[model samples]
Target: MEKIIKEAIYIQSPTYIGSYKEEDCIFLLKDISHLVTEKDDKEREEDINDGVHYSQMLPFEDTPSDEYMNIFYESLKENAMKVAVNTLRICEQILKNKGNDVILVSLARGGTPVGVLAKRYIKYKYNIDCPHYSLSIIRDKGLDENALIYIINKHKSTNIQFIDAWTGKGVVNHTLEKACREFNMKYEVDIDSGLAVLSDVGRCAKIYGTREDFLIPSACLNSTGSGLISRTFLDDKIISKHDFHGAKYYSNWKDIDCSNYFVDYISELFEKIDTKSGDKYTDINIKTAREDLIDIQKRFGVDSIRKIKAGIGETTRVLLRKIPYKILVSDINNPNVKYVLLLAKDRGIPIEIYKDMNYLCCALVTFAE
Candidate 1:
């Protein structure tokens, strides 16, 4: 296991076609799905509250159908330029604040796409070849300490910024903050947990591209759009101390990999954006995600806030990653959510129309064991 873990990463490797530039950062992950250790949707509710780490439960993976993928791509193609500009604008301020010290450590696999785009935009606009490292961070497991050690060993800067695609009830956001504090207290290294995301509907991030819960094409697919990597995984049996968390590199999916295309499509749009007036999103939906999530937890009787996922991106994740009891979509017919509807239907999951909700949709985890 140690041999495989060490050989899996390419810290000195250059950016290549099959793998990503993330080769510079340590990737302490490898595919362990063959263990067949994953659980179904019915096991989600009982095991979630058991307080075991979510990844340890191993939710079954279901790849979205071709129709579902096409909708997501079309949505991204239409809005790529605009979204790219907004992302660049948000990342610009972050880059300025961090200066020559910008070390973007995106929480893989969701944040990998955003991190790459930010890296590409910086190269496009400021001529800075910023280094982006995609690492694993499970909410309950905390940020990967070994990964941080690997980065510090290379860069030695506390100016690391965590990035994610969006905030869903801000659980991961909150988890990051807590993880940073714990890491600092344990190792005396200062790491900020304020994540940079493209969408911050939960208003948990100070550095965000937008607060709208829209369809992010990246959020639509599992790993095909995320560097052909599998969702991150961790377990004591497969992962040992002094090792980074694990994830599978889906090398076989290279033909369909949209990771590079997604970034380039957005990078081309950075030139068109007028950074002077890109403040188009809502001014921080500033209510605490904790409070909002409490209400959601009560309403859904999900028993735990972690089981109740809010926002369009997160709801899509629930359907994709876990067994969702029902999806609360404001409009199943909205083209933005068309893929979501298909995903739910494909899984035989129920969809409900809740027009007055704050987000595009919310997915409640099955309460039954």
Candidate 2:
């Protein structure tokens, strides 16, 4: 298919909702894959504790069980529209507050969908076609220089807002700030990484649609939830001096395509949102989330802060990819928590339930390194 936008914008492949021909000018956001595979949980804790980077390993590709999938679909049906509506409401607020002059830079892979939704939201609601670009931002490594250049030269935008799907432990939030600072120092471009997201369970970023970290339905599935694009990689073989970081499209997963379903489900909810008036969850903040991490670090006596991953998505990630040390859940009764618990039990990892967590019930991967 031809590219979605008329300009020189590029779309990557393997996006969750749809696929583009290999020769298409735009790249699909679906090519980034999970490095941590299902079996890694056995050694996840030790490796992370021992200074192994979490990005180096692949998470297990455990297909959700039939019952678990049913719950995901049920949640999609029950709350997808609500989430979408609220998301649109948030987008409307952001556009009014920030104006259509700023650039929308999505943190590639995860933030691409939200960026696209925000783009669509702007065009549909205000009749303004804002430019949207998904850029690669690897934790620790920094944002892709070539991608930033491509965007800056094309639109000449100085004011940019970075985006992601949701916040987890606020690691990426900090990572983005650091990356932007280095980029500005090197290239003389002033880009602020103050991020916007669908949810801010970590309470870190200034702009977001929701503060609750319950279950984003999108978190339950991988590429299928976003555009079928794999995660971005900055490795030598795939990237070069002039070219942007590249990824492969999982052209094979068309059989179980859920990309459009996820996009449209949220887009349709735009009508239900009041746009002008809605209850914003502004009271919840990131300080508590950070404090929780500090407590976990103190309790576990781990040296590195990165080892203490939290939230459902991060915890689910621990079970799927890392060799989990243990899982501290918010509620054993929560259905979403059940699968994580099952995965933990199956792996023989310990699990403890606690009800104190605000967005997520529990935390995971307490490294005793």
lDDT of 1 by residue, 221-265 (tens): 777778776767777877766456766566767777777777767
Model 1, TM vs. native: 0.83
In order of appearance, the predictions have TM-scores of: 0.83, 0.78
Report every candidate's CA lDDT. 0.71, 0.63
Per-candidate total of colliding backbone pairs: 3, 46
**Lowest-scoring 10 consecutive residues by lDDT in candidate 2?**
20-29
- Residue range 86-172, candidate 2, lDDT tens digits: 567567667766677766777767676677777777777788777677767777777776667666665666666777888867878
TM-score of 2: 0.78
When summed lDDT is taken over every stretch of 10 residues in candidate 1, the lowest stretch is 1-10
